[model samples]
Target: MDLTPYVETLRRELAVAAEAGGDDARELAERLTAPLESAARLTMLNVLSAAADEITRELAPGSVDVRLRGLDPDFVVTPPPADSGAATEPAGSVEPPRAPAESDEGGTARVNLRLPAHLKARTEEAAAREGLSVNAWLVRAVSAAVDAGGTQPRTAEKARTVGQSFTGWVR
Candidate 1:
């Protein structure tokens, strides 16, 4: 998870490459290494993030996330949900859920959500616990809230005929 080692290796390689060019090249490499260290780390993080997104898509419903802890990037993986019938049924007997046929009903749109760092971390943890990607979790949550007309619990209505049964004989 520590990116320090990788950055250090890159710096060393750069220095070694410069060594062949002469003293001036070596001095330039040394000066640039300090400034380039941050850029190198950022590029590494980007690559890791992209790789995680690709893996997440392949996994679908499950997820792989690259989280940053200080200067390190940590990977968090959530495995696909296990089918209840799989253990009881023979291999290849249970069919995987089919992807919804291409639909024009409504397409997905990206929304840029900015949350406090702590809240973001909590959301990620919750998604991981449910074995879902953060996007999927957020979508489901938003849908439910919209469908229910909000997050508050609905008030129960008073019964109109409580214990009031009338027994009548037809005339």
Candidate 2:
């Protein structure tokens, strides 16, 4: 069946509907509506029936009859494939799993305490001794701490001090 005219009719109707009640589209709706209705009125009922049949066959179960709406009702009956009835359940059932807690920014406090005045001043002195701004100093210190697996700059530096002390002794 030639579905082109019906498809064009639907398209025109949609275009008219899309433009309805808008000032810019007022003329367009008027121009398209008549042609759309004319095409719709000329559509073959058989084509619509065929499209509906194709949709039904795709959706219905393959192993059972699917009855559809009508006066006497239409049905599509499909017998089970030869070995379908003999299928057995697989051995194991999976246990439901627990969902892990969500992680979000700033959810856990990594920075334990604000530096005390003496410690803060020492930190500033340490940065100046290393020729860096406080931010840069902290960044370097953090990198060192992470590399040496410590929480604080002093702990990371302690590892180096201990290493040097061991190497410099008994020379």
Candidate 3:
């Protein structure tokens, strides 16, 4: 399902909440609008699924019992018990394994790019011809270019610290 409407609703709600915090907060929310829209567009389904998974893990460590309001009446997902000879780790102890750096496993990170309209249209056509999603097609093209040593050398710079950003959802 297209989630643009839902995202717009969320953004409107955010603006309303910020209004309650007075002018400064409202201005900040205005500044955040573009980034928020971009994020929602990019990570629509993944964000929702990840949140549900996290909630299940927190509530029932080794098992999940989720029920969608109008979908499934019995949709339980139970993991193997620790003592059932399953390779189980403690809840929230170990981080999940990372895929190889260049592997096209999925969108582990989001990168925004700006291309000319003509270039974008051509790229979409090329992607369609190759029977690949636009993202996968772009990834493949970039990988080929990198492999062919087509990238310019970059000057080294000192790494800088970054802070976390959060969006809280309360019941």
Candidate 4:
């Protein structure tokens, strides 16, 4: 959204308010307005982000995100799938969920790693696609790889077919 108009309106209001105090106050307001523009934009962005989060909560399984483009924030909304609660996975699909397990059995540790800008963006996109945060997705991935002792991590297809059965008549 274009914030120029809103920021301008704020500046105008500040100027009008300072007018009551005479020339000194008016000059100070003009000087301060230039610095305050950035602060105002940041505050506005924060408000937009909070609003998007609240809307997302009310639209669970769907989401709203505020993306910054230059100085403006844009809203991106992902509506719930038309088939909502039908199988979450496509038929014959074998991708495992990457959500982090909720377990109190282990202590948490923090590690710092840096990646190229492109890789970081890709990781964020992958996490968003799976409805998980980047940290959670990374933790799940690391757990899978470590559990395999550096061998190839098992895929969902291999992990589930053993001792699984369907006991129903097929038409």
Candidate 5:
């Protein structure tokens, strides 16, 4: 009575049936009800500590390399092959998702910058060409650069708000 193969086989069959019903609404709801659910959101380190304990045990120390890896508590897992006789890694093994570790700036990291007066004026003139004030222009410029795949960490919300205030002051 080798139940290992039979029990696992039955488990797989049941999982396939359960999955055919549709997407995991429980998981989706967890993600969708965010900000609202953000308060309940688990940190990745905590999640990794709990969510996939079995898989993490298999990883070597320092194998988990990531920056924004801790940003998402979720990990994606791939299923094992359906062939029963094959000796392979079990299904439901977890893998971490992460952002690239390096940037295109050739390892020169960004620092807080104070704009020089002439450079600021040049930026203001460019903004003027776009019918924007200097601060607004810089915000828009930074946003555009981000949209083009730059990974700046600075928040533009404050800059944009100040720019709008400047708009009023100029009047």
Candidate 6:
């Protein structure tokens, strides 16, 4: 998304706020424009908007509310309600849910992992050679690893059987 216009709007707002303080404040605000623009470009829009709102509150203390445009209308961005019950936790205090046990079954879950580009390429190559999707190949590999207690040596016979099982299941 093109953030240039949004950055410009923020710069203008800051400049107006600084003008109320005098020449030094205006100059400082002007100097902040480049860094602010960089931050806006690098950050996700919702996060950037939240941060900008916080900064506005700090600077003017309830006199100004900074709201970003172009977000979905249905997406309401508001502060979390103050905790009033045991069931409610303060924002940023809750822990993310732990991953399920490896042996757990039924529903599938998605996980994101960062792999080196070359490693990803090699895995893709191997998956292509096996005529299987990367995800299916990885699932089989992990299942095999667990079943074999991580010590079984890879052999052509085992590989052939694994491939056959996979194709048979697909068919």
Identify the leading candidate in terms of lDDT: 1
Candidate 3: segments with Cα more than 4 A from true spot: 1-44, 47-107, 151-171
Which residue ranges in model 5 land beyond 4 Å of their true spot?
Answer: 1-113, 151-171
Error of 1 at 3 (Å): 1.0
For model 6, how does the per-residue alpha-carbon lDDT over 86-164 read when each residue is reduced to its tens digit? 3554443433112123344443345786889999998888666644445545655565556557575554443322312
Per-residue lDDT for 84 in model 3? Answer: 36
Clash list (residue pairs), candidate 5: none
Ranking by lDDT: 1, 4, 3, 6, 2, 5
TM-score winner among the candidates? 1
> For every candidate structure, what is the RMSD over all alpha carbons to the true structure, in angstroms?
11.9, 26.8, 19.6, 8.9, 23.0, 16.8
TM-score of each: 0.60, 0.24, 0.31, 0.55, 0.22, 0.35
> What would the TM-score be for candidate 2 when compared with the true structure?
0.24
Mind giving the per-residue lDDT tens digits that candidate 1 earns over 1-171?
A: 989999999999999999999999999999999999999999999899888876765675666889899889999887766665456654534242322222466533458999999999988987676567787677556655555465454443311221222111122
Alpha-carbon deviation at 66 in model 2, angstroms: 74
TM-score (C-alpha) between model 6 and the true structure: 0.35
Model-by-model lDDT, in order? 0.70, 0.44, 0.54, 0.69, 0.40, 0.52
TM-score leaderboard ranking: 1, 4, 6, 3, 2, 5
lDDT of 1: 0.70
**Model 2 local distance difference test score:** 0.44
Q: lDDT per residue, candidate 2, 54-74, as tens digits?
A: 443343212122233431224
Q: State the weakest 10-residue window (summed lDDT) of model 5.
A: 162-171
If candidate 2 were superposed on the true structure by all CA atoms, what would the RMSD be?
A: 26.8
Candidate 3 lDDT, tens digit per residue, 26-138? 99999998888867755655555566455443433223333444322233554322343224534433221111243455433558999999999988886565444465556
Candidate 5 deviation (Cα RMSD)? 23.0
TM-score of 3: 0.31
For candidate 4, give the lDDT of residue 111.
Answer: 93
